[model samples]
Target: MADKKPEPATKNPKKANLLDHHSIKHILDETVSEIVSSRGYVEDVRLSNVRLLLGTVIIVIALFAQFYKKKFPENRDFLISCIVLYIVFNGLLQLIIYTKEKNAILFTYPPAGSFTSTGLEVSSKLPRFSDIYTLTIASADPKSISANPPVELTKSVTKWFTKDGVLVEGIFWKDVEALVDEYSKEPKKRK
Candidate 1:
């Protein structure tokens, strides 16, 4: 018999792309943007960028104030003002974000089998300030959408990036690919 060599295992392209921390964030951002836009919401990148910059600056100032407090005890009022400003700024931003059309019902999916549906609700006018994203998926019996009965479903999770943009230790690239694949599937036509 002739000697034969074994074939090397090939990595999935999607999974391979998701392996990097930066790419994972990028893909998730793109996917979420698509998902949100498909439901009729526009992504305000200018607002998003403004929120991110302001939030970052506030945090940096707070940290600097904290460090300064230890070195110069006489300047306690500066640290206090920075902390107060940070809190007040956040409260005002939240008030602005929730000012118009909050918790808008985006889409209602047709029943999977026969009796239930999964609806999506979104904070339609909120400016996204952080890296963390929240998607609300509600499942209820289709006939009783008025009653709004809740159905138990599996918890959704994602590989989170650190404050410094590094991926955390628990989630892997394959896991991310699996999540994206499952959610990206086409829906069945209703009869």
Candidate 2:
């Protein structure tokens, strides 16, 4: 058999290229917000699935009661009692959930990760893999600064160059070295 020519992969026509012009921070913020919001959406879907399954089972049992009436005379009373109980119980649960909607939260899935240390607590809002990019931190060489002693050793200066080529000096107390290290390894992270 002859090998067929590989088809050109179709790109999404509707996908927006608007984000290309935006900064990394803007993209990171949007990604973080989407990830956080999806938690509630996921829980809503889970609860909806459970509600559907229970409703289906209840309907199936009701049909079974009707069809087996002739063969199961002794079980008729039991089935009827079960039907009443099921209706009442399910109805009560629905009423309670519906009425308490304002007071109670619809979903309560636990947070993925949380940490508290001393008086201040910390949480990581790391960006998705696709957002990874090389961020350059250009610090003035100590030797160069020493030769040109206008700037003291203790008060050293650094320049930050973002992936988007926008250069900003004195982006204070920035962890660019650590961020560069993270950017290299983060995309390859398994979990």
Candidate 3:
């Protein structure tokens, strides 16, 4: 029998485009403009910048007042009150501005699933593989897996195989548990 050459492994081998480049400056400019022009509450860069600057200045002044309070101990309460007032005012202003912007944005993009004041709908799609892998890797207990091969190998393989796999409902539950565990270690925030 005549020897025949083996067929090429892949019919269309995907080519890596290492030369693909995008202008960072252009992207940055576009992003900046988009954020600045955004109709959401926190979108107005000019207003936000001004408020932030004023708030910072007020905070510095308040600190200085506290430092000098030893000389005028009688006015300590007044200085403290002023500081509190400035902080409250700044926070309230920011909240109002952000709320307005958020309302505007939400109004522009109405919720597709349900009617809402913000007009935003919660997406029903499952989380991506990267998110799942991250949560899994972060939650992997050292005692659970044998310390033979590195955990990274297992994580990488899991991520690779599950990249396009259908995410079962249990996966979401696992992710939620992982998230809760992760956040439990952090400082509690006021609702």
Q: What is the C-alpha local distance difference test score of each model?
A: 0.43, 0.35, 0.34
Clash pairs detected, candidate 1: none
lDDT of 1 at 60: 80
Worst 10 residues of 2 by lDDT: 114-123
Q: What are the models' TM-scores?
A: 0.33, 0.29, 0.28
Those runs of model 2 whose alpha carbons end farther than 4 Å from true positions after fitting are 1-35, 38-50, 69-79, 99-108, 116-191
Per-model clash counts, in order, read 0, 0, 5
Alpha-carbon deviation at 186 in model 2, angstroms: 28
Model 2 residue 93 lDDT score? 51
Q: How far is candidate 1 from the true structure (C-alpha RMSD, Å)?
A: 14.5
Ranking by lDDT: 1, 2, 3
lDDT of 3 by residue, 1-191 (tens): 02222322434332222222122222222222232223121222444466677678777767777676356668777777777877776777678666543312111232134222222111111123322222111211224222111111112213222233322223333333333234223334599
- The alpha-carbon deviation from the true structure for residue 162 of candidate 2, after best TM-score superposition, in angstroms, is 35
Clashing pairs in 2: none
Better of 1 and 3 by TM-score: 1
Error of 2 at 136 (Å): 41
What TM-score quantifies how close candidate 1 is to the native fold? 0.33
When 2 and 3 are scored with lDDT, the better candidate is 2
